[model samples]
Target: MASILITGGAGFIGTNFVRHWRRAHPNDEILVLDALTYAGNAANLDGLDQVRLVVGDIGDTELVRQILRNHDISTVVHFAAESHVDRSISGPAAFIETNVVGTHSLLMAAKAEWLDRGSGRPHRFHHVSTDEVYGSLGPDDPAFSETTTYSPNSPYSASKAGSDHLVRAYHHTYGLDTTISNCSNNYGPYQYPEKLIPLFLLNCLRGIALPIYGDGMNVRDWLHVDDHCQGIEKVIANGRSGEVYNIGGGQELTNIAVIDAICTALDRAFVDTPSLAQRFPAAPAANGQPSASLKSYVTDRQGHDRRYAINASKISNELGYAPRRDFAAGFAETLAWYLENGDWWSALLDKAQR
Candidate 1:
C-alpha cells in the first residue's frame, strides 16, 4: 500500500483532495501537514477516518524529512502556498516566503529522502499550481496551453511561477519524479469567503451590497474543485514525470455573469421558505432584477488580469481526464452547500475576527 503526504491538506482544494483521496484509496495511508493559516480550517477534515493531520510549516526541512521517513511516504502532493492575489498585493513577503522558500525546502527534503535513499519503487511528486502564471489573455487569444510562456502579473502568481520552476529544475537536475498541473479558478464547498464566489454568496445572503471588481467583465475559467481533484488523481496515476498539464472546467464566465447566476440560484432556493424574505428583505425578487440591482461595481484590483483560460487537452488526451461537472449544476450545488453550512463558515469568520 502506498503512503501519501498531502501538504496544506486543510485548505480548500487540499481538503477536498484529501477527502477524495481517502474515499478512493481506503487502504492507503494518508498524512496531512498544514500550518492552519487563516484559510486552513481543520473542520474541513473533521470526521475523516484513517487520515492523520500534522500541523506544521512545510518550509521546515527537518520536520518534512521526519514526516517522510516516519510515514514512509511514497507520494507527496504539494498544495501549500499563499494563494490570494489581493493579499499577495498588500504583502508580497509572505507569498515569497511560503510559495518559493517553502516549496524549495519541501523539494530538498523530498530529494534527500526519495532520490538519495534510492527507493526502487515509482514515487511521485505532484505539484498543484494556478493558471495565472501565464498572465492575462486577449479577448480572442487561445486558451493557455502547456507551452505558454510564464508571464505572471501578480505577486501570488510570480511566487507560484518561481516554485514551478524549482520543481522543474529538481526534476531535470536530479531526476526527481515530478508533475505539475496548472488549474483555473476553483469554486466549491469550504472555500474561504475572500474568494469571489463564496464572498458574493455570503454578501447576497446577508442582503449586503455585492462588490464586483473592475467593470465586472473580467473572464475566468471556473473549475469545480471536485473535478480538479479528480484531474490531480489522474495525473498521479498516469502522468509522465517532468511534464506539466492544465486542468480546466471549460466553464468560462464573466464576473458579473457568475454573480447573476448566484443570485438567481438564491432566489430559487428561498422560494419555499417565506421566512427568508424577513431574513434578507433585500434579496432579489422573482424577476431577478433587484438581485442584479444589488450589484455595486467597485474599484478594480491592482494588476488584475483581464482574462484566464486553460487548454486541458493534454490531460484529456493522455489520461482520459475530462471534467464531468456542468457549471450550472455544480454551481447550484455549491450555493446550496454554503446556504446550508452557515454554522461552519460562521465559526471560521468568528475565529478570523479573534
Candidate 2:
C-alpha cells in the first residue's frame, strides 16, 4: 500500500481523481492538500471518508514539507493549478503565482522530504498538465504527440508550461522519480461551473443565453474525468521517470457541436417529463436567421486557441490506457450528474460569482 499526497485535491479534476484513486486502491493512505481557494470547494469532499484533507497551498513550502514527512507519502500527485483560460486572461499574476512558483515550491519541498525519508524508499512525483501547452492545431495538422514542442498561447498554458519544465528539471537534476501527463479537455461530474460543459449546462438550466465565442468552431478533444484519472493512476504505477505521456479520449468535437449536443440531451431529457418541460420549452424556429438560434456569439477570448487535439498513442501503447467512456455515454452521465446534483454546483456558482 502506497502513501500518496495530492495537491489541489478539492478542485474539479483533482477531487474526481482523489475519489477515483481512493476507491481503486483501498489500502493506500491518501492525504489531500488544498488551499481552499475560491475554486477549491471542501464540499467536493464532504462524503468522502478515506481521504485526509488538509487545507493548504502547494506554494507553502514549509507546510508541504511537513505534510510530506508526516504522511510518509511515497507519491506526490501535483494537480493544483490555476487552469481557467479566461480567468488567466483577467488576471495572469495568479496563474504565475500558483502554477509556476507554487509548483516549484512543491517540488522543492517534496525533494527535501524524499531525501529525509532516505533514498532507498521509492518515491514518485506525478505532474498533471493540459494539452494547451502545445498551442493551437490547424485543421489538417497532426494531433499533439508527446514530442510536440511547447507553444503556449495563453497565460494559463504558459504558466503550466513553466510548471512542466520545473518538473522535468527536478527529475533530471535530482533524479526525483517523476512523470508528466498532458491531457485534453475534461468534462464530468463535480466540475466547477466555470468550464464549458458545466457553464453551458447551468446557463441552459437558468434560462440564460449560451455564449459562444467567435463562430463557435473551436475544436477540443474531450476526455471523461474517470478516464483521465485512470490514465494518471497508470502513469504513477508504471510510467518511466523523466518521460511525458499524452492522455485523451480522442472525442474530437467542435464548440458549437458541444452546445448543440447538450441542448439536444436536455430536450430529450425534458420530453415525457412535465416538470422538465415546464423548466425548458422547445427553442423557437430559425425565422430565416443565418446563425444558429441556440447559441449566441460572444467576444472571442484573449489568446484563444482554435483547436487542441492530443495523440494519445504513447500512453495507449505503453501503458495499455484506453478510455472506456465514449462522448455520448460520458456526456449523458455528466449531464445527468449536473441535473441531479444541482445544490453542489449551485453553491459553487454562488461562491464564484461572489
Candidate 3:
C-alpha cells in the first residue's frame, strides 16, 4: 500500500511502466505528473485504476513538493525529459532545461519533503537514463558496462549525463535513497511516431519514402518496452541505493537490417491478410512489389554515434534481470498493434499536422 509518483506518466515508456507497476502492485496508490507536451498523451493512461493524472511540469519545485507531501509519496520514478536526438541537435536549450534543470528541481522537492522534513518513511528515487551517455562503440569495442566512462556525444545524451550526475550528487551529498538505470533503445506500442520503429512503420503504411541516414549500417541494441519496464521494476524493488544498472535486450541489428525486416513483415501480412492490401493500397506489397523499393538515402546526422550496446551482466547477476521478448515476436506484435490501433496514432498525427 505504498504511494508512488510517476513523472511523464503520459509518455511512451512511462505509460508502460505505470501500467506494469499497477498490475504488479495492485494496492499501491499512483499519481502521475505530466506537462501534456506534444510527446505526452493523457489519453494513453485513460481508464487505468487507482491512478490520478495531474497536468504540470517537473520544473515546478513547489508544485512537486506539495504533491509529495500531500500525497505521502514514498517513491518516485522519474521519466520526464526531452529525449529525441534530432530535436536536441536543432534545439539544445530545451534539452538542458528539462533534462538538467528540471531534474535538479525534482530532486530539491524530494529532499525537502522526504529528507529535510523528516518522516521516518522509506523512500526511493529512480532515474531512467540512456546508454548514449557512454558515447559511440567501435566494431570490436566491448559493450557499455556500468563502469563505462561518461562521454556523451549528442545534446540529448549530454543533458541526460548532466541529470545522471545530479542524481548521483544528491545521493552522496544528501543521502537521498536513489538508483539509476541506463537502458538501450526501446520500441513498442504507444510510442510517438518520431522514433525509428514507429516512424518507419507509419511511413510504410502510407507508401512514403523510408529515409535511411548514411549507409544505414549503424548498430543499436533493441530492447522491447516490456523488457525495459521489467528491468526498471527489478531495480525499484531490489536495487541498492546509490548504484547504477545497465538494462539491455542483447539483440543487436544494423539499421538497414531492421528496415528490411519491417518490409518483409509487411509483405507477408499483405499476402496472408488480403484486407491489409485493401487498407494500405499504396503499399508496394499491395501490387506484388517489394516494400524495399521505397528506400531513400539521406545525409548522415551530425555527431551520430557509430554503435551502442549495453552489458547487462550487473543487473542479471545482481537483480536477476533478463529480457523476455525476442525481437522477431516483439516486432511482429508491435507492427500488429499499429495496424489494429490506427485510430490512436491517427488522432495524434492529425493534431500534429494542425
Which candidate number would show the highest lDDT if scored against the true structure?
3
lDDT, each prediction = 0.92, 0.87, 0.95
Model 3 clashing residue pairs (backbone): none
Query: What tens-digit string does per-residue lDDT give for candidate 3 at 1-354?
Result: 889999999999999999999999999999999999999999999879999999999999999999999999999999999999999999999999999999999999999999998786899999999999999999999999999999999999999999999999999999999999999999998999999998888888888999999999999999999999999999999999999999999999999989999999988989889999888888888889888888999999999999999999999999999999878988998999999999999999999999
Model 1 alpha-carbon drift over 4 Å, by segment: 278-289
Candidate 1 vs candidate 3: which has greater TM-score? 3
Tell me the lDDT of candidate 3: 0.95
Alpha-carbon lDDT of model 1: 0.92
Q: Tens digit of lDDT per residue, candidate 2, span 137-188?
A: 9999999999999999999999999999999999899888899999999999
By TM-score: ranked, best first: 3, 1, 2
* Residue-wise C-alpha lDDT for candidate 1, range 124-150, written one tens digit per residue: 999999999999999899999999999
Rank ordering of all candidates by lDDT, starting from the highest: 3, 1, 2
Candidate 3 stretches greater than 4 Å from native: none
Q: Model 2: runs farther than 4 Å from truth?
A: 116-119, 277-294
* Error at 57, model 2, angstroms: 1.0
